[model samples]
Target: MPSSLPSTLLFLSAGIFLAITGTLDAITFLAVIGCAVCSLLTITERTELAYIGGLALISISLILQAVLESKCITCLKADTLILAAVICLTPFQNFKLPAQIMSAVMSVVMFFAVVTVVPVESESTDIKPHGFGQYLEVQETSGEKLTLNTAENPVLLFSPSCSACEKALNKVMEQDADGTKWKLVLSSSKEKDIKKANELLKRIGYTGTLYTYDWHGSVPIVIYTDENDSTIVSHSVDKTIPLL
Candidate 1:
């Protein structure tokens, strides 16, 4: 059996364990200890490359532990047990030095590596508020005579044909904005399509302004108006929200 293969396997196992557990834990600590044992064994056998390789494995393990944020107690227990086992085996060879000293050095290096490179904190911001400047102006269609009040709050449009648009509209419905004023303008290029849309809205019991024959239905564009329904905030196609 090749002696180096065991160390290689140990290193691979340590990497897999760290990836699953994420920053710190008992497993990572043990892996560091195992590397030191392998290193000492290689050193006594005059296998300098193997010794270096073992130390490298230990270093890598420590780095992973540090990155993952494993607890010191767990790491210490693992290191001590593995080093103790290696020291016991060192007596069989004509070694100049005990494994204890080498193990101690490797452990210290691992601790420093973790402390230096801490995990960065990440924050998530809602995409809805990024470009949400003002409320869109949703007046009644040319045929419809209802002049609905514009809700000072944000409103997203939803079309019937698009399933994705329906899902987004559902989310808006669930959102807590009972006091917020909103109007849905059902626009269709064809008169029949507009009639179908009105029928669907009526069937679903949606009490909002219905607009038909909207020639300017560019889609996903949020409209912003001033106090006097004069100017627009901006005309943009927001793909994140179905504002068509």
Candidate 2:
């Protein structure tokens, strides 16, 4: 085997590390390890095990998600990589018809798994905030900018002190961004909360800019605006935001 292949596989495995939720999502890292294991399996004639191994990792990821009630996009991607590698290799090609049939079944299953697991990012101008923001006319706690309903995309008012707020922030950062951009407002009263929230954002590797504010212990809030700057969804920061 070419040495470059292993390097390439590892490079692919690392693609998910760029996610801003790297600190919050352990499943993504697990997928990386699984990919590495598959890479090693490729060196053997039993490369077919790579698919099985990857499938097992995916299963475990899903199980973990079920128990935790959270999903990992990067982990699913890692499994998809393994499935693709298996399809390309097709170790059962020279085997008996029964074995080849089984391979086909596995391939089909993998295809469905990929389709089902990957999340679709919404670019639709109208998104459901799920009844959270109910037309709350609110001004920016710190800045001169006000948003009762603005053209801006969803903005998360992050608080460093609240654990619920942190979890909600993680979900928004990981699930919403598929590439949607948003700005961060440091809207908390306690200086410690602001400081902590900033540090958490940095650790999460959040892609968007953080808007620094002189405001101080306001609750976390999410403001969703339509193209007309009309408030559609308004949610305050808290652990409960995950339900939205």
Best by lDDT: 2
Q: Which digits, one per residue and each the tens of the lDDT, describe model 1 over residues 40-103?
A: 5554553444444455554554565445332232233333333333333333334426445665
lDDT of 1 at 1: 48
Tens digit of per-residue lDDT, candidate 2, span 24-113: 435455666666666676555455565556556656755764453333444455445555565554544354465456557766765665
lDDT of 2 at 3: 32
- Candidate 1 segments exceeding 4 Å error: 1-155, 176-180, 202-205, 213-218, 225-244
Deviation from native of the Cα of residue 38 in model 1, angstroms: 61
Q: Which stretches in model 2 have alpha-carbon errors above 4 Å? A: 1-21, 24-30, 93-223, 226-244
Q: Please, what's the RMSD in Å of model 2?
A: 11.2
lDDT of 1: 0.41
Q: What is the C-alpha local distance difference test score of candidate 2? A: 0.50
On TM-score, the candidate that comes out on top is 2
